[model samples]
Target: MIETQDLRKEFRDGRTTKVAVDGLTLAIPPGRVTGLLGLNGAGKTTTIKILATLLRPTSGTVRVDELDPLRDPKAVRHRINLIAGGERMVYARMTGRENLWYFGQLYDVPRAVLGPRIDELLALVGLTGAAGTVVERYSRGMAQRLSIARGLINDPAYLLLDEPTLGLDAPIARDLRRVVARLAAEGKGVLLTSHYLAEVEELCGHVYVIGDGRHLTEGSPAELTARTGGHRTVRVTVPGASPEVEAAVTAFAARAGTVAGLDRAGDGALVVSVSHPGEIAGPLTMAIVGAGGTLAGLEVTEPSLEDAILALNDAAWLVTA
Candidate 1:
């Protein structure tokens, strides 16, 4: 397990000091995909770097399988690998196959073992055909895939991914997610940092919400959303409703008085935004029916992970970690 307690990091410029990670506590256990979520300047990447032994913490304790990263940085590096989103990791001049082979060699894997491992990784990232092609020719998504392949070359016990799917197309991101799932299933602890909350909710067993380098809250995606008393949308569609139905909807909207506003969608659906859709949905459905309108569909859109996290960050409720 890789865990931290009250971890903090600060940078200094002359007399000014800026804290990058402030009192962050999180745990990533083997066979589980844990997510570290925050806005761009929220210090998520700083925390990941500390665990990967890239940056030394200013305070608190960090353990990678019970070994102190500061005390045994070399051992920590050997046991973990970080795949940052971008084209910086792979060698642009090298072929996709050569890049993996080179990283494998650096990790000191035997050529006999490394050769086949490279092929497996290339296939895993859908870069098998592009294996012989120089990385310069690979597209952005392909490069990101190659970067993922390189991170796995060492086959480390822990993997840290920073924005692994930042700019990739939907299909490419889906494929990378599968790779992440496979890694966890194989017993490697995966620590993921991403702005894509839906992806995090889908892949992570638990998530740590952070802001301004401080821990906001940590829980299963559902728990976090349940804790969030944010707004929910109850969409009521009355297909080809008479003007009487529209007037009824307008009156209901007046009575309900949602601060988020009730809207008429482009397709003529009535979108009612509220803090509690559960309390209003039944009456909302009845209003259309009482107006002599045929109800086409009624759907409730719950508070998503992104919504919950944003609410959590905005509230800044401090919880004991």
Candidate 2:
């Protein structure tokens, strides 16, 4: 639903020019959550602003649903909703219901439909009880919920959520995640940007990692994990002494890919990482036994989103090895 080719945004100072985003080519599919993840000052906000039609890209082309945002800003606004990070708050003086009603009116939602939409969104975001209370009195979580309701005022086809769960408590963050999933399931294309790697992994089917104002990598969570080629770590603790087990792990490491790293603690415990996690149990076990080791317990560790992100951060290793 969204595509950008060689997107670049540049800022000029007295003598130096800085590129906030450079050569960023990306595609966000319909009915899927696509995460734009990066650390602070990594150009996430700049990218989102350009996509939302609030800022024009310095170079390249951007199309949302085949509409050029720069040429048809009005039409683009009608089709997208952007709940900016740290800024999804309603008018503090207006009641939650009033805030929703006002935003709905701006979206041209008919007065007859406004009431029902307000009620539905308030309930959807778990703010039904505070619908009548002024936003100024609402807690941070309540205001965040109301902001979400405002974003849905137009029932937008594309949702741009920048840190939707930034300041919420755990419970509220979980609730927001559920809401985000439901929106996508309803066929809304979503571009979500957040610092929370776990949240992005849970919500986004695909992700684009940005670093140093450039596109570092883009792929599904599993695909990116596989590309990193980091060894999968396995931890084992056996009750009795087993010298054979040590030899087995080393041999499995060599054949499976590379042990890469190993850590042994007191009490006959071993932590082993082989090039591939799939060979951890069967091949590793046999090797341990051949060395006269008896297995008492075994646990496998798979690559996480954090591991993939770390690999993205290492510029020297990217697209090289």
Candidate 3:
């Protein structure tokens, strides 16, 4: 398990001091994937670096498997692997097999054991056929595959993947996602940061949204969506609508826990907010007709994860304002 309490990190550049992470608290339990999401300069990388023990937090408590990172940097490092996308960490001059062997040696894996381990990792990453090929000859996807192999060479219990599928074609990205899922299934805690919200929604069991070096919200995708008011917008057009029909629809909306607003489509339409349009569409239509209003048209629009994130940011801005 990984846990952080009131984590904060700041950098100083001569006269300027920049806070990268501000009192961010989170946890990553074993056998699950946790997603860290944010725009540029949102402190995702900073938080990851601190957890990886590459950078020390200015103030906070960081523990990996009940071990403090600052007090036990080497031990903490041994339990975590940080795999960053768009990083050419492997030597282009060496074969894929050689690169893994080299990293295994760095981790002090015995040569007798390292050979078979390298073979296993190459096979695990589906790069066995290209194991003898030089990394310089490998494509971008192949290089990323090798990078993942390197990260696993140490057999760490925790993994940090930063944009693991960045700049990949659809099929390749899907394949990598499968690999990541397998890792999590193997009982490793995985912390993932990605620009692809769909990927996060598919893989992550829990997600954290951060903005301007602070955490905005954290929960399962469904919970965050509901919390951010990411509901379906249903527009019901009623021809020659009367005040009675409007009042009935308004009452229905309030009962459904949503606000009904008047639409100036010039067709006397009412825009209703709802978590699920199917749950209320038929009932609303029937109610309007019962009130002597003709249902001319209806439209339903569902919100996306992008919409949820934007709403979170907007709320954060309002709070800080």
Best by TM-score: 1
Ranking by TM-score: 1, 2, 3
* Runs with alpha carbons beyond 4 Å of true place in candidate 2: 242-244, 247-278, 290-294, 316-321
Q: All candidates' TM-scores?
A: 0.91, 0.87, 0.81
Clash list (residue pairs), candidate 2: 244-291
Please state every model's RMSD to the true fold in angstroms: 3.0, 2.9, 4.8
Tens digits of lDDT, candidate 1, 1-321: 998999999999999999999988888999999999887789998898888888889999999899998888878888999999953699999999999988987888887889889989999999999999999998988998999999999899999999999889999999899989989999999999888899999999999988889888889998888887655777776666777777776677668765334567788765544445347778767887999888777777777999988888777645423
How does residue 125 of candidate 2 score in lDDT? 89
- Report the candidate with higher lDDT, 1 versus 2: 1
> What lDDT score belongs to each candidate, Candidate 1 first?
0.86, 0.82, 0.86
TM-score of decoy 1 = 0.91
How many residue pairs clash in each candidate at the backbone level? 0, 1, 0
The all-Cα superposition gives candidate 2 an RMSD in Å to the true structure of 2.9
Worst 10 residues of 2 by lDDT: 235-244
Which residue pairs show collisions in model 1?
Answer: none
List runs of model 3 lying over 4 Å from the truth: 233-280, 283-302
CA deviation > 4 Å runs, candidate 1:
239-279, 317-321
